[model samples]
Target: MRGFRRGLHRRSLYHRSLHLPPSPDAAHAQLLALHESGDANAAARFLREKTAAGSIFPGFLSSVVIDRACKSGDLRGALLILATMLHSGTPPPNQHAFASLIDALSKSTRLADAARALELMRDAGIHPDVVTFTVMIRGFCKNRMMERAWEIFQEMIKSNRCQPDCFLYGVLIDGYCKELRMDRALELLREMRVERRIQPDVVIYNSIVDGLCRSNRFLEAWKFLDETMVLQGCSPTVVTYTSLIRGACKAKKMKLAVRIWNAMLERKIQPTIVSYSVIIDGLSKAGRVYDAYRVVREMETLGCELNVVIYTTLIDGLCKSGFLDDAYALYRIMKRSGAFPNQRTYATLIDTFCRNDRTETALGLFDHIRDYCPLDVAMYTAVVSGLCRERRLDDARALFREMRLAGVSADTHAYNVLLHGAFRSERPEEAFRILEELGDDPGCVANLLTYNTVIAGCCLESGMVLFYEMRQRGIAPDFATYSALIDRLLGSGEIGRAFDLCEEMLASGLSPPSGVLGRVVARLCWSRRGDLAAKVIEMAMAVDDTASFSLPWDDEDGAAQDEDSQGEELGSIKDGATQEEPVP
Candidate 1:
């Protein structure tokens, strides 16, 4: 296996490039040594070349190599070994080697290749055994190729060399069940009993029950478990009861779930952790927290310790009911009882605590949990957002840095949170640093919200540069994007450019904020640029008739003087934005 992996990395196509013995027989010996020493690639190529040259070798050695290659997932290598055996023709390729080849091909979902290999085996006058058919049926069933699987089964029956075993029938039944064809699955069950006189076991019945439950045929599923399995003398396993219990939970039939649990116990079947988890989760989600506690007590009676899922589910129920104190107490109990909290466990308490104005408590809990499990991105992001909300920038920054030290990478949302917090705290340089840091992070990609945060926080010139970069990256700017740019433009006395953006915004099927629009045209009329102002109102009236507000162009009401003392410079700026000027 190691040699095969090495050969794959070498990029060489043939054994000629490899160091080997000169004589073909000696070369075969070296190949065997490589095969034994774990060099699959070189060994495979040597066999292929020897087979191509018709160099004689033992068929048993070829079979040994073929089986190992297939076992190691080297299908091409296995085929080469088979070819070498066929070419030598001393003891000829047997059914076992072909069966192994077919099994490997089927597992790889190369159904066509498997079929061809089966044909080759038959043409060589070697027939397939029960093991061969079983593997083929299992492969087809696994891939949901029931049609081809049925064909193979029928062919096997006609051959009459071996009778179909219970396992083979189980595969076919399971396949139909997974496909949700319960009618066909039922037919097979009947055939297994009436035609073959083979009694169905727990596994076969479990598949049918699961299929019926999944199809919402609860009554029929119960009938099979209660009547059919009992009559056939097959007892229901933990998995059998769990499927029905899970189905009841999904349907919100808590009464039925509990009844199924009791019935399983009546049969002296001990419920697994999964069975308990399913019941606990169902009860918790249904707002039956106290009843869920009863189930926990039952678990205690059996000396079954609670897991993270059980604790987390109950804690979530308590938290949802606004019982924060009880939730925290349960969290402490879980930690003390050897059930380590997962991300969901910590995140639930932290988020609820943060949301309910208990930020300090959430941070304390987070600080404690960090020593147990390496903090994930979600937990770190939640705490950072909460810290930012409380304006604790220093603590948030320390935690952000600690994320990297803990070998956890900050995602884009975390970066955006810090960027927003920096700006909200009036630290623009720190915000820029965050943006630059995001740029260096190959794992994180900035989304539209990130760009909006940066652009909203930056100066007009820098914001414009960043906006241009945003569009160049193919992140389409929304109304918020244009609104931010235009608002900055208007505030900076760049009314002409702001109006241009307003046109772009309208042209892109976006209605700029009415308040921003009115401000833009009003400033244009105030600047004595009546013609430009008129054009802006004309376009505005097209999308929204109310946007063409009546301008005081006549000055009959004694309006103030024009604000454009530097009309020529304003015109120059209007014609083209210059590098020296900070045009909005």
Candidate 2:
């Protein structure tokens, strides 16, 4: 038995040598070693040389090297290796080499190469197997080339050489689901069971259920869970229930999540760590932070040890809901419970405290993270923004300067946040300076939102001058600029000037916002330009009546009215106006 085992091992090593042949058997051994060590290029070179000497490299070794390269996301390298192997007088092309290449190319996102590989396989007189077709299907799915994938699938069925397996069915069905083509997903599901006579396994059912849930077809998903799984005596596993819970949470069906949770508990379906994390995340996202905490406590009571993810989720949820104090408390508790915070946890805390204008606290937290978890730009930005929000512009500016000294260039969002803080803190000049700095940097130009923000800030105190400066600097004004101008003019009771600007905006080929126009109308009415106000109202009506006046003043009354009555009148006016506009 020992001699047989040694012989088997020798055969295994020699089989690997055919794909990567060196000068001598010893060199071949070295080449095989490299291939075994995951060096696809060396293997390809060696195989090519071996084939040139009229030696046919073993099909399995070629497959192994190709597979390793493909799985490692080096499809291009794998292709080059295959080409080398082909040049070497290796055995004529076969299904395994071609099929493996196709799968590799597809996984590498080289869709065109994948298709070519498939064609090459067919040309070499090797019909692709189910694995080949399935691989191509997955590639098409990834590229959103669903039509092409389906075409290949049909061909696979037509050949009838290899039956479609559950894995193949799962890929196609899931692909349809991903595209939100629930109808097609369902059709595939039914066909697989009825026409194809293949039993849908847990993966198949999970794919369908998940697809349905993701599409927000909860009722249908539940029906599948109830009828298909339970009625068919196919017990649903943790993945199915977890997906359902997560989906229900995303759909904001808290009640349904509770029901699923209870059912899982009763069935003794031991929830994985991921299941607990999903539920905790769901609860937190729903703003039921307290309920989320309750879940954590329950896990502890049930002796289900919580992971760091659960603590982070709880802290993040508390912080998002303006419960910074509570988040801090949770952080303390998390430490006491012996789960050390990760970088993400520290980032969340720093960001939360900073956003809530707790710059000191945020800074302290950042300092702690800097000592433990590595701090990133987000951490600094949060603290900077917080400082700015608290009117501590000096501290914010100092932080920015420090970030620069540390070789950290500001991202667009970080710069915009700082600019806003400066603008709000009565430092529009500083805000303008920041914009000038940003304009000099080409990397910050894609997001027009940042431009809008800075421009809007310029509209604050004598901000019109800055707007003119922006125009002179060749920066095009977006709808946001017009919106800001309209808002500023309306607030200052400069109705006539605001209307003139609106006209200019229209002349510039800008799309008019009904909301802004409606505000203009209200301002005109306040200025007692009843005729123009009525005209503006008509224009507003032309665009959207649903946004018509919600106030009692019309083009006359300037004083405040009862909130309830005014709200009702506004609703009535809007509803009446909506009924009049054509759908086009």
lDDT digits (tens) for residues 49-124 of candidate 1: 7776766655655665677678878898888667556656645566677888899999999988888888878777
Top-lDDT structure, candidate number: 1
Cα shift from native, residue 55, model 2 (Å)? 5.4
Q: Clashing pairs in model 2? A: 51-89, 550-570
RMSD (CA, Å), each prediction: 22.0, 12.1
Runs with alpha carbons beyond 4 Å of true place in candidate 2: 1-45, 48-56, 68-77, 92-116, 139-163, 227-233, 285-291, 297-305, 321-347, 359-584
- Tens digit of per-residue lDDT, candidate 2, span 1-584: 99669758866877676666454565456556778777777676676566666666556556666776666766666777667665664554456667777877777688888898888777656788888888888999977778998998998889888889889999888889889898898899889889988888888788878888888876677778877777767778888998898887876666456557666665567778898898889878877777777777767866788779998998899888888788889889888989998877887987887776666877876776676766667777878878888888888989888987887777888788888888789888888788777778665642556656765776555557656766777777776888897788878777788888776665565667668877887777777888987765555445444433343222233333222211111111112222211100
Highest TM-score scorer = 2
* Model 2 C-alpha RMSD to native: 12.1
For model 2, the local distance difference test gives 0.73
